[model samples]
Target: MCLRGSLHGPSRCGRNEGRDLSLDQPLLRIERLTKRFGGVLALNDVSFSVRKGDVVGLIGPNGSGKTTLFHCITGFLEPDPPSHVEVMGESIKGKGPDGIALMGIVRTFQELRVFRRLSVIENLLMSAQQYQEDKIVPRFLNTGVIRAHEARAKERARELLELLNLSSSAGKTAGSLSFGQRKLLSLASALMPDPQLILLDEPVAAVNPVLIDKIKEFILDMKCAGKTFLLIEHNMGVVLDICDRIVVLDHGERIAEGAPQVIRTDPRVIDAYFGT
Candidate 1:
């Protein structure tokens, strides 16, 4: 059994053991993605590919376009023309955020986006509301399909709560939880949709050390279960520990892309972070 079983339950263990990680096509491809805001160019021709079942880290200085690139990919902001963001070989260029999310892509914000007044479980359930069948007639009739969907969503929410060590606080308001716990809640909310690719913005920032470790464990467990992640993180230790590859951005362009060891010693990365 996976070590995570003790904390995440046996049902979650070994689900992806021997799962193929070598898919021919990249799960997500960003080609010449650029974003401009009036007089400022936020992201200038950034490009990268995230493979199936891999965790890729996006790291750079504060204004290096990491979050801007995420915004462009997830549809919060449109990329300039001639730029393409593809998932499973299909272009999602003009799709809205909802469209992109339904395409099996979901993102979490750097700031906490949880409903402050809602309970932990409620927040998660709300995140899955987009997947519910909401036809007026069906909703009015309380159709079996809708009930079953609600049940499944609740089940998944509880499972994620346990996985993140937030089950004990399931009934508490999101605003009442500690900062670290709230961070975990945001992650749980992101997973509610069972997305193929999860974009996490500063997932571990400002989180306590213990919770940071817990978050890292949860991410590794999820990756082992065949999930792909593109994350923006400044914690190099966490990045090096969890990511299969690192992409370094500087001044809105990719300056380095390689394994963790290579990124750690790359002269360009060194200069970008430490100056000449």
Candidate 2:
């Protein structure tokens, strides 16, 4: 399942025993997190723990600051970085977003950030961000490096295409896909890194019903495979269906958290989602 783990690396252990956290380690832990944009407090001392294989939902009213929190986690924003973030018990507060990704954390955007000019497969190939720079040097030297990179890239791309059910259009240019399809493509590309944890920003927003179901299924499949996710989504139907736990935010602060059934009936959640 982990391609890079199988390559040119010495392997010898009965198992990579982490924290004994039921399945895998506690892949992510957030503590006392805060964010500020000018005088606006986007997130206020929020805290949560997401273990390996847990699919937790982050929900809040529009402008309640869900996306702002994601930006802080992913290094797109640097507001009080050192005040939060821990991966496998190690602090990730000072690291840049690239550093975070390399530490086996990956995420998709609320607005898909795909390379439009690239073909579908090529776009995925570019998802291997860290490796691309290494391959570039080989291409400049007129060596087997570029050829090898292409072979591996194609192999991974094919797998992702099939996984996302986009195999039929693998060779098509990415810019031509419908908005829903583009969203799915961005998600598949994020999976190319085989991250231990992924933070999805509205993975099902603005998609057709059929595609939404497909995306929901994919999220469940990933959860069963021991992958962790912290999702930010607005669709309560989809959120209640897939999330193991729900965290509600209001005006940039955590208001409620629990199982879907409990959360759905929560007065705070109801008040936040609807009105008093």
Candidate 3:
């Protein structure tokens, strides 16, 4: 991997590096991945794969290491040496967080992060910065180039907001919106990257039903258009309704893996949290 004058594609593999692989390859592959913080292993030998166009649910009670697994995948938490993580089948473990993001994996936080004072459209514009051209001098001096790119991203942002039913608020200040609106906006912010696999850390948590429905609709539409997702959620109804498959983790390990009904009936899942 080398950096010439500018960055290309996601990761540091350059623009054409991913062209050889099929578009439908399992968008994310984690193998024998282990992450330890000092003495204890937060995520012990966790392994999973997310294929294109599938919605996989990651469920577990608190302390199940679900969030830690996400951190490892997103490059927020590095794996112990001698391990590998591949996004769209390309090794991305050592690439660092931004590099991983450039590799076509994007996500939203459990707590929404956005430009509170900026307009909804402005928040989206900032999210699109990952794809901006590298020449800062040209961008600063050339008003035309900046305007063109800005307008283009704004148009795309409008489309995304409309998909989430936030189009009407496009010109409003992001901070002025309701809490649920901010949650949906956070999701829209992640999609600005056109990522292949999006890691959602509790997208529906603390959101009202209206915003929850909005998030659900957008996720379904993305799946229909061939996007992959591994969602971390506590809302059982939403998980069962949208997931093609479910993976349950408890106390830092996998407890069950199957369809929603099988998972619902599993004694282990019930005992883990629901109680016998």
Candidate 4:
């Protein structure tokens, strides 16, 4: 269960009591990952590691299996045998989406996914509801515990709204916000759980230039507070600016992986993005 603490502070959950938090092991590791749908290979032997405080970019042409890789990591899809997705060195095989979330991995979609009818704060609260202890008898007998949990959840939601510059629109319905604001809300909702690894899907895809800068600032702020991110984005400028390292994918295979400078000048990466 998620413990009540500052959103950007060190993890306070009991889940990590005996786990390794050493520098030698990465926060997330993907090994020999492959995914196939009806003989159409989505990912082939893809492998990478994300350190505890690095913002890594996954860049590739459209249909390069970026989203598919996200799905497999977040438990929306399972990888083929011999493929391993590990969080803090533990295999997450057979763990569904909910289970994976509890292990501190959260993601946002390529398409906006907000509760259209719900207020902005309400939407954030809903994202946190899954973590509440929901035992029927305990709920009836221990209303105080539930109330405490709710209060903490709201506090975190408001902090996120303020961090994302959406505090003024807390009472507004999600659908009423501008497209970029909605995208900000999606990111805020994902942060509610205070996950260790955040997988962002095209975070600045269609926003105005001003909002794109705002989004970049938000991500950088979060990074300073010790958040680790693995984002898929086509905006090379944004990726190069924010990412410490990048993994270039082409046709479901990892073509290159290195620092931003190295990736920028890599012939294979250049060829993949702009064919010869």
Best by lDDT: 4
TM-score of 1: 0.90
Residue ranges of candidate 3 with Cα displaced over 4 Å: 1-24, 131-147
Q: By summed lDDT, which 10 consecutive residues of candidate 3 come out lowest?
A: 1-10
TM-score of 4: 0.90
Local accuracy by lDDT, each model: 0.84, 0.79, 0.79, 0.86
lDDT of each residue in 1-276, candidate 3, tens digit only: 111221223321211212333455677787777777788777766677776767899999988889998888888888876557897679985787788888888888887898999999889989999644367898989999989877777777877887778889999999999999998898888887677788999999998888788788777767665567899999999998888778888877777887787899999999995668
- lDDT of predicted model 2: 0.79
lDDT-best of 1 and 4: 4
Model 2 lDDT-worst window of ten: 7-16
lDDT of 3 at 118: 100
Candidates sorted by TM-score, best first: 4, 1, 3, 2
Q: Please provide, for model 4 over 47-163, each residue's C-alpha lDDT reduced to its tens digit, 9 standing for 90 to 100.
A: 989987678999999999999999999999989977998999888999888888888999999899999999999999999876443466776789997798789889888888887
Model 1 residue pairs with clashes:
none
Assess the local accuracy of residue 252 in candidate 2 as a C-alpha lDDT between 0 and 100.
91
Each prediction's Cα RMSD?
3.7, 5.5, 7.8, 5.2
Candidate 2 lDDT over 95-168, as tens digits, reads: 87887787888888877898888989888888876523244565869767667766877787786677678999
